[model samples]
Target: MDLHEYSRYDAVGLRALIVAGEVTAAEVESAARRALDRVNPEVNGLASPVFETALGHAGAGPFGGVPFLLKDSGPMAEGVEFFAGSRSLRGVRARHDHDLTRRFRAAGLAVLGLTTAPELGLSYATEPARTGPTRNPWDLARGVGGSSGGAAALVAAGAVPMAHANDSAGSVRIPASCCGLVGLKPSRGRTPTGPDSGDPAFGALAEFALTRTVRDAAHLLDAVQGPGVGDKYTAPPPPRPYADELGIGPGRLRVAVTVRAWSGVAVDPEVAEVTLKTAELLAELGHDVTEASPALDWEDVVHGTEAAEAAIAAPFLTAPGRPDPARLEAVSRALLAEAAELSALDLVAMLDAQNRVSRVVGAFFTGYDLLVTPTLGELPPPHGTLSSGEEGHTLRGWLEKLFAHGPFTVVFNLAGQPALSLPLGHSVGGVPIGVQFAAPYGREDVLIRVAAQLEEAVPWRDRIPPCFASKP
Candidate 1:
């Protein structure tokens, strides 16, 4: 297999070839290395290359021998350096495999390397002072939405069919929107974050990946959806394998669509137009699509999100070998200061706020089967627009900026709902515009079915990025 042939197949397709003996796993791995080498320089998506170690990976299962990349953050894999895009933790390595990483190995994904993220995964853009910017494959001048920006870029550039990603505040969906890939943030507790951590960010964070196709997303969820030992909670098991959901028709349903951001940010006109068109398309498909939004207290939402982000950054900043002040980015340093001042009562108040917001959003879902919105408030912005190193940003101001760029995604994190972003629209300039479909908690099956419908309705298989690995 060569880079061209290798780049043509998604993970499932590559697995099929491997299973049928059409191409050896070694050949596929070699081709993936070639793809990575060809594209990584242009996109700067890779944070650490463990090619030799990955070449020795051997396993058998559903995705046996398929090449994959881990995000620079967690679910950690033993011996793989995990900096979380931070200069302070530059040489840190995981002492043991995170439960999800073990599951990925059992599922037969060959771990290639770690991808870039913002410092401590703080920003909506992946321009880490530690690793520089992760350029969007669609347009080199634009940002790849963070913190899964690197994973999305590699998958978009055909360096790998899919790569590890996670979401607490739109990390997965934002990048998928920016890069024209399928990003699914599973219901809280649907996937593990265990052994080392339990329900990080108070169940706001969910682990998953970004993929080139919906079926790949479905298949992967099937392989890695269960809770790990000692998990705080678990999502209800699906009625059937998620892959089966792809073929099942999402029966006529009520969908609430909105272009307005809950935070009141002015959504880009192009993004709004695409979202309205997507709603029209849903109506044409026989569903009752209405322009409606859940009433949310933006203040509560902001406070809750800040608390969660602070919780995520706490241990890293408070560790005995704490990050040196100068080594940390401006925003990270600000977050450290904020984390130090955070009181237990403050955390409890924020958690209360999150619970209230979740209840309100949950009630809205009781009236609608799904909520459709633009995955982002705007198109992918130019690099440095959301830089972590830029000085003089309070945590509140920084989050406000992030919410402005990606106001549509983090609400679902607070609500703990299953949300998916599909590349169903594009800007006049050819940048991909993602439309998000969110379902009630533990209803990824519903999102998957509807996503499959849209994937077929607006096929993006031929929309290749300029920095693609297969390009001559």
Candidate 2:
């Protein structure tokens, strides 16, 4: 295969090719560097290119020669500087390889670069004013869903088969949905988080990568998803080799479908159409899919789950002798100010509400193997809506817009279950739309099996974005 072909192969596919002696680690690394040199200028996805570092590290493992990129948020691969996409962390460097990075290397991935994220992984769209916009490979003028937007763009453009991304509030799934790829947020504690921290945010979530194929996600999970030494919450044991579950096929699932609550944001007709079809598709797959609204008060403002996330994120933000306090944007500053005023009772209320939401959501999942919803209620907003520092927009308004439109995602984050965002549909103007599929906590194996089956049913691998060069 040519270098271009090497660029397009997912990790698993690349492994097969290497075992067949069709490619070498050096060849794949060279291909990735060339592609990064070619495509990154327009997309602004690559934050820290590590071509030489990757070339030196290449060789051995299942993915020994396959190329990859990582989002800059969680931790850095050894030798590469990790910026976390902020002005404050501009020159900071990693002293050692985080566990996930070491596992990926052991499994044979050649890390070539780091990707862009919103400042401190705060924003939903990756249009940072400092490093400029991380443009969607599909539409350079549009915003790429962040904070994994950088990883998503490179993978979508066939620069690499897969790249690391972490999801807090839909970070992994959002960018994967935006870029028309497969993004899976494995259950909390499914993957090891060590060296810098263990289970970021007390087991509220976990991290992984977005990929072109379901098998690629599964293979990576097989390679890297393991219990660390001191996990706060432990997921159930995965079936032997997550890839084997892909072949087993999902049994008939009790699938539930829900629409976005009327948040006053106009639902894109294209998204609605695809969401309805996706439900039908699930039903056709011999599963029960019902168009039912979830029973709960989503709009209740009882100092709820959002506050819990804020509380979990505080020490990292407020820690002394770290990123300078003055360097934070006004939005972060304002949030810190609001957090300061939160009393003990306020925190108790937040934790209590989260418990309530979890109880309700958990019961709902008990009756179903999967719940399907639109990943986003609408298409990408016009650029500059977020991080523009625009006025008359309360933080509540901004957050409500994101949550209502992105209803299906954070529920799982709160419940700490596994969720998958599959880019299966397209808008009339050719923008991609994603559908969410979630299973019981630690049941990522189930979601991956069904998704691989669905992917075969409706092949999306051939769908290429307009902005990416089809032939390099």
Candidate 3:
């Protein structure tokens, strides 16, 4: 198959060709490798290559022969290193498929490689001190947002149709917003985090993917959405397959829009402008759009995130023969220091606060079907702008800096709602800007329906970035 032709089809289209015997999985895998060769060097998106392993598992199943990338953070395949973007875990290999990874394999996604992430996924940029930055495909000097930044970069650059991504405080949506793709964070407990540990980071984290199309995201959720045996929780099952819901009308709905950052920061003017424009578009599409947001305690979000980070990082800090202090990033070290001081009582208090915020946000959703907001406080900022530099940063200071990178996103993580970031606008500087649509728990169906409608109303599929791999 011609490389250009190969890059044109999304996962479903490629799957159709494979099923009809028009293109073999091997040919598609070869095409993906070529795309990676052309784009990965410029993008710095991949952490490691597993092309041979992908080749070995290319054919059969529903999405047979489709090239895919798995983010380095989780959903790891056996024998593959699960580095989590740190030199500390460089030699730690997965002994078996993470339940999510097993489902991806069952769906016939050929996992071509692992993608880069911030060290310990503690930052919003994909610049791990060990792996360097994953450059934005649209602008080389700018960053690809993280920790799913590399996954977004690869998909944006046409290196693969879609790749694994997850969110804890908007890892998936942040990058998708930065790179012009579809990123959906399924509701808490929507996807498994088991056969390893339950409730990743106290249910603040959820796994999903970054895709170029809404249907691709929907199909993937279909493939991987379920509770593993002994799961601590499970999302309410969709009435039907998410893919089947794509073409369905969302019905006339009420959407509350906000350009103000819930964390009390002013939205970047360009981002705000685009958000209002999107609200207008939604109104035109027959939804009741109003400028409103829930009045929840933002402090609760900050404290909850701090506790979760501490709980998640404590294990790494206590691991034997951990990375030398010199190797760890400043923010990561600060987080470790803070986590070490946190007690069980402190965690309980934070959890109570988080649950209160959840209840508050959930109550607001009763008045509105969805909440619309800017996906990020600003366009993808310049590299190093949001980084808590290597010196003199305290844990509180570092957390503030990181939250500022995505002030609008983490609230939903706190609420455990299904949120999606859609590439709906561009800034004056021409960087892509995204608008987020968040729905109450177990309501991804509503989000997808609206996403599909907006996709048709303002199509972005042909808007390729400058560093794209498939450009003729």
Best by TM-score: 1
Residue-by-residue lDDT tens digits, candidate 1, 6-102: 9999999999999999999989999999999999999999987655758234467899999999998888988776788888876677888998898
- Alpha-carbon lDDT of model 3: 0.86
Model 2 clashing residue pairs (backbone): 63-108, 64-108
Name the lDDT of candidate 1. 0.91
Candidate 2 lDDT by residue in tens digits, 236-271: 888688988888878888888865642345556788
Q: Residue-wise lDDT of candidate 3 within 194-280, one digit each (tens)?
A: 877776778888888999989899998998898887789789999999998888999999999998876787778888888899999
Compared with the true structure, all predictions reach lDDT values of 0.91, 0.74, 0.86
Off by over 4 Å in 3: 55-58, 318-321
TM-score, one value per model? 0.98, 0.93, 0.97
Clashes of each: 0, 2, 0
After superposing all C-alphas onto the true structure, candidate 2 shows an RMSD in angstroms of 2.4
Query: Which residue runs does candidate 2 get wrong by more than 4 Å?
Result: 55-58, 262-266, 299-305, 308-321, 388-397, 469-472
State how far residue 429 of model 1 sits from its true place (Å). Answer: 0.7
Give the winner by lDDT.
1
